[model samples]
Target: MSTHLCSPQHVLVLNCGSSSLKFAILDATTSDEVISGLAERLGSDTPSIKYKYNGEKQLIELAKGQAHDAAIAELVKLVNELGLADNLIAVGHRVVHGGEHFTESVLIDDNVLTAIEKTAALAPLHNPANLLGIRTAQQAFSTLPQIAVFDTAFHQTMPNIAYLYALPYSLYKEHGVRRYGFHGTSHYYVAGEAAKLLGKEREQTNVISAHLGNGCSVCAIKDGKSVDTSMGLTPLEGLVMGTRSGSIDPGLFTFLTQQLNYSVQEIDDLLNKQSGLLGISELSNDCRTIEEAAVEGHPQANLALDIFCYRLAKQIAAFLVPVQRLDALIFTGGIGENSDIIRDKVITQLGFLGLECDEAANLAARFGKEGLISKGQAHAKAFVIPTNEEWVIANDAARIAKEG
Candidate 1:
C-alpha cells in the first residue's frame, strides 16, 4: 500500500474506542504510514468510514449504522482488496490498561487474551473495546500473529514510592488499587527522541516529559526508565485535561454527595465529562477556543488557562525529585506540540531550574514542527518533539512476533 517499495516488516495497528476505531498500516522498519483509516459513529444513526490509501482520501457511508463486527469486516475486505494482507507481518492492538500483568509489548496468545479480559474491570470503558478490536483482528488475520501494546506498560518500572496509595495497603493488595500511569507509548517515544537530541544514550539520560493533550500526564525518566509519573490508578489523576478534572480533592466527592444529592455516576460524569476548561470557562473544551477567548480578555477563559498552566508547571517541577539533574524538558501531544503560549507559560514558571523560553524558537515549533524552544545557552533546555506511538507499536509488534 506504500507509494514506495514495502519494507520487510509492516504492521496493522488498531486503537479502538467504545464507539470508534482508528487503524493504520505502517512500515515498522522505516516508520512510514501506508494506509490510515477512522471509523466513527458506529452503531448509531449514521456511521461513516473515512480512510486514506494510495495517496487519496475516501469516505464510505453506512446508512444502517454498522457495529464493530460489520465495520471490522468492511475494513478487512478493503485491506484484502488492496493486497496488503500478505504485506502485513503482524497486527498490533493498543490496549489501554494491562493492570500489572503486562510490562512490555507481547505477542498475543489465548492466555494473553484471557489476561486482558480479566483486567477489563480496571479499565471498564477502554479494555473491552481494545479486546473487541483484538478479537476481530484475530479472526481476520487468523494465520498472522496479533500483538498488544499497552498504555500502562512503560510506567511499570516505577517504584512503590511513586505508585503506592496512602489510604490503605489492603486496597492495593486486594483490588490492585495503586497508581498505573497512562500515555506510556507516547511518553516512551518522546523520551527516546529527547535522548537523541541531547546526544546521549537513553540509559544516560534524565528528563521530564509533559504529554499535554485532551488528556495530559507528566513523566519523569531517570536513566531510560520511568521513575515517577503524575497519573495515578486512572488517567484522571494528573494535570487538568480538556474535560477531566485531574487530581481533584477527595473530600469534594463526599461534599457533593451530601450537599448536592449527587450519585456516584453523576459525580463521575461531572468530573470526567463536564469539567476542565469547559467547566471553568463555561465554553468549549478545545484549547484553541479557550486560548483565543483568553486573548480576548474573557475572565473565565483566562482563569481556566491560568489554572491549567500553573498545575502543569507545578507537576513538571515536582518530577525533578525523581531525576535530580534535568538533561532536558520535553513536551509532546496535541497541545504540547502546537501551543506556543501554553509552552512558554509553563516553562517560564520553571526559571529557577535554568529553563527559559526562546520566543523565536517556541513560535517556530508550532503546527507539528519540532524545535528546541529554550534559550540556547540555558543549562536546562526544553524541546517540542512530536510523538509517534504508532511507530512504537508497529516496531514492538514486529520484534515480538519475530521472537515467536
Candidate 2:
C-alpha cells in the first residue's frame, strides 16, 4: 500500500439515525461542503431520498420497506449517477454511544466495530442503525477508509463527581452506568466556534452550549473540554426534547408499573418516544406546532412551552457553576436556530446570570447563520451559532485517513 498522502480528497460524512440517513460530501483539503442530502423514512411505506448539489435538488423514490443497507446502496447509486467525485477517500459515521472506551474519533476496524456493538444497549435506537450504516458504506465503497465520530466522545472528559449517579455503587460498577452525555459533536464544535467568534483562545474560554432540537443537551465547556453536561448514561437524561421526557422521579416508574399495570416496555415508550412536549401538548411533538397552539391561547400548549424553557434555563444555570468565568452561552440545533420566541424566553430567564439579549439581534438571527444576541455590555455573552456536526465528522475522517 502507498504511504503518500492524498490531497484535495473528498470525504463523505454519514449521520444515520433510527429512521433517516443524512449525507454530506466535503472537500477534505478545504473542509467545505460539496453536496448534502437526506434519505428519510427508511423502512416506512414511503421512502424518499433527496440530494442537493450546486443549487439543484434531485429526489429519488425507493420501494417501501427498504432497510438501511438498501437505503445506503440507493444513496451510493445517486452519488454516482449525479457524476459527483468518485475518488471517495474516506467515510465518517456518527455513532451515538462509545461508552468509556472511545474518547476520540477513530479509524474503523473489526475491533472498533465490536466495541461499538457492545455499547449498543446504551443507545438502543441509534448505535444499531449507525453500525448498519458503517458496514454498508464500507462494503459499498470498498478500499476507502471509514471512521467513527462518537456523540459521547466530547463528554468523556467529564469528572467523576459530575458523571456519577446517586445510585448504588454496585449499579455504577456492575452496569457500567454513568452520565455519558450525547450531542458531544455539536457541543464540541459550537464551543470552539463561539470562542473563535469571541476572539479568545479556546483553552482560555468557558462556555455553555445548548443544543435544542428533537433531542437536547447542555454542556459546560471550560478550556474546550466538557466539564459537565445534562444528558446522562443515555440521551434520555437531559433537557426536555421533542418526544423524550427530560428528568423524572424514579419512583414514578415503579408506581406506574405496580399501580397502573404498566410494563417496562410501556414505561420506556412513554419516557422515550411518547413523552416531552408531545405528551404534554397532546397535539404534536414539533415545537413549531406547539408554539402556534400556545399563541392561540391553548392552555396545555402554553404550559408545555413554559416548562421546556424553564427547565432548559435552570439546567444552563446549573452548568455555569462549574466554569470560573462564563464567557458565552450558545444556542444551536433546530428550535434553537429558528425560533426567536424560545430564545427570548430563555434569555429573559437567564438575566440573573448577566445575559441581556438585544431583542433586535435575537430576532435577526435565523436561516442558519451565527450572530451575537447579547447586549454589548452584558456580563456573559450570548450567541446563536448554527451547528455543523457533519463537517466535524468529515474532518475527523479525513485526518484519520491521512494519518494511515
Candidate 1 residue lDDT tens string, 1-404: 34534566889999999999999999988998888999999889988899998889999787676878777888889988888877888999999999999999998989999999988988888999999999888888899899999999999999999999997899988989999999999999999999899899999999899999999999999999999999888888989999999998899999999999999999989998899888899988899999999999999999999999999999999998999989999999999999999999998898888888999999999888988999856667799999989999999999988888
Cα distance off (Å), candidate 2, residue 308: 0.5
Alpha-carbon lDDT, every model: 0.91, 0.89
Query: Looking at candidate 1, what is the lDDT of residue 100?
Result: 93
lDDT of 2 by residue, 35-149 (tens): 7889999899999888887778989888989877888898788768755545578999999999989999999999999999999999898999999999999899888889999
Give the runs in model 2 whose Cα sits over 4 Å from its true position. Answer: 1-7
Candidate with best lDDT: 1
RMSD of 2: 3.1
